[model samples]
Target: MGISPELRSLNLSNNHLEGPLTVSSIPLQLQSLDLSVNELNGPLLLDIPIPEQNFSLEKLLLADNKIEGPITASLGTMTSLYILDLSNNQLRGNIPDSLGNLTLLTVLRLESNHLNGEIPACLTNLSELVMLNLASNELEGQIPKELGNLAGLASLHLEKNNLQGLLPLSLAQLSNLQVIDVGENNLTGNIPSWIGTCSSLLVLMMRSNNFKGKLPPQIGELTELLILDLSSNLLYGEIPNTYLNLAAMVVVNEDMSVVGEDRHAPSARRVRPCGAPSGARSRHPPNIRGITPDSDHNYYGTCVDYVYGNEDRRYYIEGLDLITKGSERHYAYVLSGMACIDLSNNRLWGHLPAKIGNLKGLMFLNLSRNSFNGDIPGSMGNLSQLESLDLSLNKFSGKIPFQLGSLDYLGYLNMSYNNLSGVIPQQGSHMITFDKSAFWGNPNLRGCPVESWKCSPPHSPLSPPTIDVKEEAKEGFSWYELSMGWSVAAGFFAVVLVLTFKVNWRKTTFDQMDRAITFLLGERTN
Candidate 1:
């Protein structure tokens, strides 16, 4: 019961197993050992207490533990090792250069650790290596060009580090390469056009860098590219129209119905069986860990758990940290059904292409803080699955199209600081709820919520004077009064004519009238 030399496999995963793995306790002939997802802590050493002899260990999975100390060089003694995962632990110091001695190594995951120092150039010696993940660490320095020698390499992750320098041209030699993420780094220089040579590339993230120059039109060569983010850089020039040639986005957009019914439906993470690509050696890229595949199989399986906003979700083999809907978000496993192109905060200018609507499956599109002008293409309304749209701080003009209101899944929208005008259209509940702030900065824009000015009816300069017919009719006399008035007016005109013709006759008539008045008064008295 003390020690069984015949022991070949040991699995203590998903337990409260703690304490250091003592070299004296492991069998010299052990081939596979899995102590993942536990509280296992203490120094990581490769001494197997085999009395000057090397152990036959092949696979070691010690992820999600508290293991600490330098990744020891003695690990090179286990030349039979193919998979080595020590991720999500407190392991520190340089990755042992001796690891390059394991030419049989296929996967090496040291991500999510405190490891620091330049990635050992010797690692390129592992010609059989397929995946390499050294992300989420304190590692720095230029990537070694020798890594391009791994023709079998498919996935590489050096994100969230202090790495700086231009991409090595040798990377273009890896004909089988698929994913390359070096985001959140200090890297500079133009993104090499040679990247387009990686025909199988699915994702490329070089955001938050000092990279400059125009995005190579050759990027459209990545027919399988699902995500491309070069945001927060100094890149300028127009968005290449060549993006329309991206076949992956086109297919996904056309067959969106096959992906999900509700474009905004929450995706559920599912565990699936997938292995390294055929002809590949490891289960995952070298920098990732936490794979607990059974010893009987050579395939790799990943379990992804994403904490998005207020919700916690578990999904399958991928993760992304992107800024969408005006906030940073982490996505898990949903990456397969997601497509995005973020070129925000650049010096780009020119009209947004109407063909952009062709990427109907895109979930996020951010072209903010650019100098792009002209009307926002009406075709953007075709993006029914779009959840975020940012066109702020641009020089775009003309009316905001009514079609945008048709986007049922749109959760965020920004058109401010543009020269856009016209009544803001309230086409749906979601659109109606957007405040004036979403439309502000447009000087001529008017309507509910965005009522900086009132809308008025059209007026004419050459118009007829208005007449009050009713008032004139009310002031006019009736027929009887009109007749009496006409007679008095005629008598007065006749008398005036006679007095003008005969002054003497006027005096006689005056005397006769005086006498006649007196006679009339006397007759009345009688």
Candidate 2:
């Protein structure tokens, strides 16, 4: 297709367009190009020979394509570019250091590619950056300490890489940061206490790392934090009771308008196509800009034609991997009102804080495979929104609280391999749905679902009558014996009275008895 120099925006996204993109195909005045979600292959070669000052391109989105080869260094010449997303492509080789020159860049996404080598420290020179996602790449070496210099940065994703070393203390300077995911790396050292200082943090993930030491109580200071995943670490010690201070987890927020709003003021302007770039001489502006012309020789701007203003930019949490319902679920973006805490697979020990019930909004909680002891807190029932709970493989003792049966939203529960005893909570609609496996390995625990572990009836005011049939029979026998004795005595007294009153009858009876005796004696002699 022939290009128009007047074309300012070209969005051919989600098409079957294949083959490499050429520099000449892009219009000289094009300010935005979106060819994402296509089958485009071959190296992304944009070697336009336009003067740097005259180049007005601002947004280039080619994500989710099969584009390969090293990122062209000439892209660095586009000083006006602010949003560059080349993610989810087959792009290989090192990230061009020349990208650091795009000082006006706000959002840079180079993740899900084969880019290797140490992260270019010069990339931190983009002071206006608001979101930096370099995750899921083959990058090595320590995270740049200079990243703290990007004061406006809100999200930092360096997960799923071979990066190593301690998280730089300088990162504590990121006051506007809302999400920081450095999971699945070889990073080591104690999780810094200063992390609590990032008060704006909403999601903090450092899972699958080698970090060790007692979890800092200061982390509880993040009152608005919704998701906290520090699982699969070497951390030990009790969960701090101060976590009750996480107020966001304690109450559900129905209004998600502010959920992922940019902490930094948006710098991108809302642009519209204006009359064929001023110099067109036609009586009617040609429909070359892919817009329909009106009777007055003018074209109206559609919602899709403009940048930044087309959608709600506030709902942007790139991706998250969380374990819920006994499996890993990848969330494209965190549910606005969801809250979770995963501290499993650690050495954390001691009684779980009874105050955990304060987090009524918590949806997923995994404290399994720890050394937590003491009775499972009945207060957990106060978590009206709890959907998944895993407390298995612990040292907890005592009866599973009947209060848990009140959780109407509970769908997945695993309390197995603990020292817990007594009947499983079976009153709720959800609690009974769980199978025997949810309570397996607890030798002392007894309930209906556990095959051979039948629970004995508890001694409560509402318990059924326990009177034995044998005891009732024994009591009846005693009454019968008394009645029989009384009847025999009465009959004997009556017979005595009769014999005394009827003397004639008594004499006759005696004579007959004497005659019978004499007859018997005579027969024996014969």
The lDDT for every candidate, in the order shown, is: 0.74, 0.77
The clash count of every prediction, one per candidate, is 10, 0
Tell me each candidate's TM-score: 0.71, 0.76
Flag clash pairs in model 1. 108-286, 131-285, 131-286, 132-285, 132-286, 132-287, 133-286, 133-287, 134-287, 269-315
For model 2, state the Cα shift of residue 335 in Å: 2.1
For model 2, the run of ten residues with the poorest summed lDDT: 296-305
Kindly list the per-residue Cα lDDT of model 2 for residues 4-30, writing each as its tens digit: 876777899999999998776677688
Task: Give the C-alpha lDDT of model 2.
Answer: 0.77
